[model samples]
Target: MKLAELAKELKIPTESFIKFIQDFDLELSECISTNFEVKDDFAKFARENIVFLRKYSEDLNQNKSIEDIAENIDQPKDKVAEIIKKDKPKLFDNGKYKSSVSSFGIDNKLGGNYKFVYNYFGKNTHLAERDFIGYRDLFFFVSQTLEPYLSNISVQDWGIHRPAGIVLYGPPGSGKIFWAKKIAEIIDYEFKEIKKYFLGISFVDDQKITFNDFLIQIMKSEKTLLFLEDFDEIMSERSEDESVKSDDEETKEIILHYISHFEKENILMVGAANSLEKIDRELLAPGRFDVLIPVFPPNMKERSEMLFHHMTEDLSPDALLIKILEDNKAHQLPFWLEISKKMQAFSNTMLIDFTQSLKKRIRNLYLKNNSTTIKITQKMLDASLRDASSKLTGTYLDQIQQFIYDVSLNNYEDFTVRIEALKVEVEHYKIVDEPTKPIGFTHNDEIKQKK
Candidate 1:
């Protein structure tokens, strides 16, 4: 059964249920497919725990003080306060906790009976069986946003029309283009990139044509998703400090003029941007590129899955590398967990770089030893980690921090967990170095000397 269908049957809000899975740290792959198909085990668990699910959903949707949560869970107020303090959930203006603060997380921390939750994870869902690794929440969010296109009634009854333009904003290597294509696939539109040349006057079929002409031609064709890269630059607000290119200005004006016809002509324009801080407000007005989807770096679990996927992707069962991975238990998720933890805030591109570097290092080691029994060591892993960290520079981290802020303002409610997690990871880089002390000087002696 589909998760949404099951949620309807149980009278649980679909969004709440999705948050419930994340709050409790449930193994998403074990419970549901990437497409939100409910596995048999998860469906059984939900039906059997309907009362618990309903109460949990209710608690999750309301702001509550520690005392209130304690009363609801039948726990002591002091204990509840301690658990909540340790969790560090976001607080409301009224001095209560926000709904994003998961009661399920607090309950589990206080030794709540959640062993039944693990019972649903007994059936292992292989990586090969899934469409992609992690980002179940993101996929679900995109699905919800495209509901109008997916369901005719969503538009006819609810007046929810498909967005004419969407801006997928994220730091470089966060895979904004991938989500754009995924959006196209969801709406059954042909994915067509508006190439750089297409933005300028170009000859098509040996006939002189402008971007305006190109857009008109696309409108006349079958349903198409026109992808615009460097969206922030192209649609940036004109400023005195920065000179705007004539082509960019022309392109922006043309898009603004024709955007009104996009939905009616069966075209959706998805803009890929590294940031939205400079985009013109006029472009983001209603029925324009108003929908902003923030693509994120892989979280801890996703980093592990991506590492394993990259390592063992096409290797044969009997290949030397596979044998080595098996020997080290590197084929398992737990093996990558520690390494992935160290890779906090690493982008998808960085993770792939780590895998590539690791493979090359392993090859060099094999060449030197001329043996198939070479063991992967911590030194080798560390070397590859350093290579990957080369790309996780301060500039990239600043971009991620900016992304977190942008999402906090625009998409916080939808992606609270991700935003919070990313905030912690980004702050990890802010460790200031200690001031240098003179030789043979104790801390107190140095202070006295200064005085």
Candidate 2:
């Protein structure tokens, strides 16, 4: 079909169509344009017609008769055949279906039927499959689970195998980002890191771009992994009454499309959020995500392993310290590493005070969980130290329970009793072991060392 007809059918202006041809680097001669054998205007053919002609020229070449194109350019079959026979048609290798790499200059292989993901923020990270923390087992589980679904695709079908999309949901610092990165590495998929703000902007002024637009771009590229972080805040639920317009509906529709298409089309799309409770339920339903993995905080065993891994080199923490670190919610590897550094700075005489101070530090950190500018005072430390020492005695468990009840609810009496019991236990132990060390022994151990 003539360029004008293709342009009219595409809904683009005639000038734009001419410019598109120019962009394709083709130079059509005036004589060829004026002396076309057909007498029809040729501006009425649909854009899809031109697209078919441009894309399947070789196939069309097999069936075209010479008189068909010479008779009329307006005839659908003749126009299609004539356009197909072109040396280089406007839609050939230049249509929207062809992948255009974004500003990153990355390669996009659309016909390859592989997914592509780009990561801009996590540029420096190199997460391996084995390095994934809490989600390591979950990743493997999903991998095994999806195999049968993939294998069932018939050989006659053109369906391709792409990575499965995952939704990592939980509270902040729950390691979603870590797992996302590791999964990217594990699957050898290109990580396309999307900035949440940019994504919001892309749909500014009434969701200008449909979710299919984004999906088509990602799904067409080979070996791509799309990681959408902080997706909850972007698609937060809000009513019309609230100041926040409900972008949730629009976002959910897009996400639903993404989930539905990716599962069947072999494209892997991953989304992560701080809280699942805050997310739209429609996006979390079974068929869409397929798997919803919660990246929880480190449990006791994991915490112990983390502590040992981070501190085994320089610090010689005792069994009690290890147990305390493992039991305490505040004792993460990063926190313990800081404590180890502090301990390394002090002299022999200060070591006992420092070791004792560690629990207080840990407690203070715990108290600061949901705030900043909080400090650990001598009062809190004394109470905790006393409680710790008392826990060694026969009544320790009972006292601890009472103490926890009292302190948790601000019951001063219960709290005081627990503290006093711990103080007594500490004094008793100190006295019993006092004679073993010399008064001037600068490097004497503080706690009794077990064999």
Candidate 3:
């Protein structure tokens, strides 16, 4: 029950499906993130696609005959028979369906979540280009590189060069998790998430079995997206000798047999981390989890957009409040955009939190009802912007910059080609004329002149 199969049944061409996927702007399940929007026509198209999918899954079960499926999908019986015959399905006596694209009777069923296995990480695909703001180039790089690998296009001549894995690395709150999900979604693969739930515990055997069950489910699918959050920590749990550490040779056997020798086709794995420097290099081998895609902080324009987006949310504003917001908008867009440029290292989370702080103040004022007018001023937003600025870049912006620069210069060899080129460009940034002093602080030369 792959998305590609669904597309074929609906007579949606590959190009149309690609366009369909690229038009989505999903609202994040968490409040910290937001989903902007797409055009009305695009939204209608996506909805129509989803409607067909739901109906197909619901009506094309084993109880239905070939004629029934044909009627349900609005296709001729001969075409339905052709699809079934190609599957080489087990024939029932009464011309009823037994098992094929729509059936899951072959799977062991321990992975009940895997039963609805057609599309995984379903929300990832619903991302519009503008949603990522400053990540257009990196987004294109990922999509273009992954296009051939996921589809059977490159398999004919370039099978040896298939991407085994992809990793997203950046500072915290830079939307690594969001990007990872989007990648899986765009590929139309089933996305299964695994977290470091068993951290700081010692039930090695149980944890190993649980992890294996996930892999077993992956092996059971046509194409699967396995998201291993904190992958470095997960790998660290493996013991060279499990018996000596946890008194279970079975756990040891599991690692040697199942984990180490894991080489699967048509399965793409993605990992996200704040600092990949601590990760073991062995796991990053070319045939393993190799590609590294950098997810950096938003640029000035993106930050400004983020600020605007968070400020203008799903609120039914009163007349007074609306006026205040209007004034805030008319007078403050340029000022906020300028301030955002100065807040260099600030992340998406920081900007969102600052906006949320403003929201909280507004909420409290409405709830308190102490004052007749809930008048909001630009000064309050100015203060929050300044505070968020200080919280991230602060007096050590140079230090953070240098740290990132040093890491990139040193580990450029470890990164994927696209990321390595970006790293090289970062390493080459000319720092000669720029003053290293923190903003609002006295420089050494200025102090000497004052003396």
Candidate 4:
């Protein structure tokens, strides 16, 4: 008898059936994809959710009362009913749990020894502030692409087929990964991050696997999102022209195969690259990544919001401070937040003092170095900044910009002076340049050079 039928016959709640399955540690008989294809799975790792979900199939027939089933199963009748009532469709496999892709490592393996590569890309939430800013159009585009696939579970069964797979392409440190992370959070999906160095080819003689292979395997996951953070490393057009064309072709073929195979009703795939032009045209075609979304740097409004979000004590969103922030081109929110935290570390100060402190810090950062020299380098900055425009400026922002320039040029007496002046505490930076690098340093010149 089917799992659901067995539950009904015993008068047990469907939840209990699922829990029982979990308790027994049994796997499912069949493995299904977003398109409903039963993939091979001898591991038989059955999930409680899917076990109970077996009831949804039309092929299953039930002729038992809850009480009868509960009595036979030695469980409570009300509990059985509760499980049935709370059931909801999922985007992930209900029962099968695979090791997190993180365990495999992040890398771009062309033909070394790795068989399959599982790279965790960033989520969409990373770029939320950009969306709230004037770039409402861009934000809407990304939201529309992701919302339908994420908000509705039935989309996995039958839903609008969005021909476009999202591609976030930009320079390094532009917030690409941050945007990816935020998107997942806003939609309540789990975040999976993968780096690019761990990718390689491995084999027991003829059998071979690669980082791209690992990705294809995990990309088939249900309900969960797979983010290709620095996608350019592997599927990039640059890789194609380089000596790695053969391996690049293999990865490209995999992408082409899936782009054609993806069922809008089931899975959501997102790819992010540093340079869209560097991306292989075949991969970005209508079928592959139909929607090419560019994640730019923080504008003034976004910068301010990012600054405010990171502030410890509340500061008035006064016109004066806003005006100042609007003038500094490189004083994006994330950068401002870093400066603010650094100042707070020395002492606790009021808003006016803090603003002055922030301004001073900005001046040192951009002035000594170059007006463009930010604490973070272009490549190390969030990938989203590649297309972003500056929004912060005014008295406060001007001072901050001057400070940054001073630092870039090495004219500032003590870089820590501004940090000391702000009386703000330094906090860990939220954005990462490379997924594998635990910490990154910005070169004075690297931060100063503009697009």
Candidate 5:
């Protein structure tokens, strides 16, 4: 069933239903397909929970104060205010919360009985088989953008055509290339990277070829997804401060010429960019590279899971490391919670660095002690974290902030919670040094000046 059809049957607004799913942080792929087709499990869940859904929708549409919310949820006003403050909800003119201030979010935080929403799906058997660690929301968003390729109905009935080009924008090490490959996998396309040399007239297999010829050749063949790196630089709007290379101009022209035929030719081009700030406006027109997907770093929960996964991935049950992890409860999520919190804004690459450093440290410790009873200590964890923090520089944080701002302008509604959470995490790095006393200035002199 289409999501709209379900919403009609339930007498709920389709937009509200979508927001409800997002506010609850539900796994979107499980509830709805890329083309907004309602899954059987979600349909059942909605049917059974119609009463709850109606109340949530009603509350969601209202601009309520903390007192009103507290009264509605039967919680203490103080607690509700605290949660609201923590979440940093938008405010109305009269100091009431905006409709975007999710009551469902607050209720859930206050120990509301929403476990059924998650429990209905039961154990996620598919998650274990996933290629990447987290960002279920991002994966879902990418799937939706590719719905035209996945579903014929989306094209024929809804007029949703496959995007000719896509730009995956994010900070460095945020896994843009990983998602570009995932896009190809999702659409069952041949993954072909357009190397820099391919842009120029270059010899491939002793045959002279230009980028135009390469693109033509790919189009002539089966379905293909062409991945391009440094898209922001290559396709940047030509400005006096920055000169465009002749090759880059040619490449852009060729792409613009060929993009209109991409859908018909079974070709898709995905460009990886650090930011979209400098990309040419023409490139973002509808049916061109209009589909912009923002890849984000792992959140706190995902960070912990990733750490746990990396630590014990290939270890035997009886390995000394496993035993040590088990002894310290290091194999569990809680063991890594504090360290992962400190690793806020750290990219996937940085997390891997932390794991690698920690593993080498453990190896050295074992070599020195030759004991099976070694424990994973906080000192070792902190040392590994310091190594990872090398890459979490001030400039990287600024990039993350810029990415956050870009998403706020482009993809905020779809990823509100993540954007807000990341904003706070980035702010965590802000340092304020105490002002030092002026040289040769004594306390009595300061007191006299004050007098």
Candidate 6:
């Protein structure tokens, strides 16, 4: 087979094919174009090491580090370095290197290794597997988002032009941005923030140039989690019915351009929005973003986890804690519960705030004895809950419930049931606690005897 024909069949760049000729040390001229004929020797080389060649090219194209490339192929770094130096020295330039296969017939609109830029956003973030905790089902769903990267599967198998992106929508302080960072850490993908990128662009022409260049760089190099924080403020709905007016045309174009790019770009565009209603109706199409995950305020079970995680940090006995909880008549029958049912709708942030306030209150209450002892009392916790902003209004809760129903309509039936169950739980949350102790009164009898 001719090298050009091989390039067409494999759908790889002609430059990469030339690299095969140079690497295998086949009978090919230095000036050989795409039309160069393949010999029996090159055919045998392809047959024996085709898988290796493909992986090598992918690692190179991703601009992986020398250590990573070596580890991936199960070869030593020194050996791989020797192979590259002996075979293709053109790739290395003054300690800088380019992808082994790049600058195809796409007309040089974009090309570069930008893995550094992507990973820089999440430099200090090291989230362990346990750090991604929420619900068991939700954790599984988020894990599935990385299926394409974790396996040999292709997006075409799922009938998608490119892998779908995720949009996490919920109220403020619900840990939307935090999850995005953790997801990126799990996949070890490049994490790039979008808001600052827009602010850094100085001119209209620069918007077009920067967007095109950056996206192409992302598509070529490796996987990326593009965190579009404040997505609602950035990308407004596309109003096709009328001529939409905007004070900044450049910003508008930049947003629409990148959102549209998710259709074909392999990168994951994780957009966080407080409300899905603010997003454009058209942008929810299957190709743009396939998943609409609702990050509602922690329900009863999750709120309990958050509370216990913070509350049980002391060595105090469970007996003491239960006694303190029982005195307030707040958590009802199960002493393990955190906060009253009315406060279940409060976000994790608000719950943490409430717990911290309790600690402070407990300290002040213990000071009445003029001692530094850490003996927490019921009065302290009750006063703290009253002081903290644990009251999520009825109207806001109703809105969140409606949003859950709306988004669940787009998901599987099982997910719909899970979300709907929360509403049912909220309706009956005010169950009264039956006290174990009763009061005895002799005031009336004593008064009659005295008379």
Alpha-carbon TM-score of each model against the true structure = 0.82, 0.36, 0.53, 0.38, 0.81, 0.53
Which 10-residue window of candidate 2 scores lowest in summed lDDT?
Answer: 101-110
Question: How well does candidate 2 match the true structure, expressed as C-alpha RMSD?
Answer: 28.2
Regions of candidate 1 where Cα sits further than 4 Å from its true position: 1-11, 23-56, 74-121, 152-157, 428-451
Q: What ranges in model 5 sit over 4 Å off? A: 1-72, 84-105, 114-119, 122-131, 152-160, 316-318, 412-417, 428-451
lDDT of 2 at 318: 57
Candidate lDDT values, in order = 0.83, 0.41, 0.52, 0.41, 0.83, 0.53
Model 3 alpha-carbon drift over 4 Å, by segment: 1-130, 157-161, 198-208, 232-265, 316-323, 330-335, 363-378, 386-403, 406-451
The true-versus-predicted C-alpha distance at residue 366 of model 6, in Å, is: 4.8
TM-score, structure 4 vs. true = 0.38
* Winning model by TM-score: 1
lDDT-superior candidate, 1 or 4: 1
> For model 5, what is the alpha-carbon lDDT of residue 142?
80
Candidates 4 and 6: which is better by TM-score? 6
Tens-place lDDT per residue, model 2, 329-429, is 33344444433332211112232334455455654565657433344355554553344333233232222333333333332331233334333432332
Of the two candidates 3 and 5, the one with more favorable TM-score, higher being better, is 5
Error of 6 at 44 (Å): 40
User: Residue 279 deviation, candidate 4, in Å?
Assistant: 1.4
Task: Please provide, for model 6 over 323-354, each residue's C-alpha lDDT reduced to its tens digit, 9 standing for 90 to 100.
Answer: 54445442342443645454655766777777
Model 3, 419-446: lDDT tens digits are 3333343333224545564333333455
lDDT of 1 by residue, 13-40 (tens): 8777777776676767677754456888
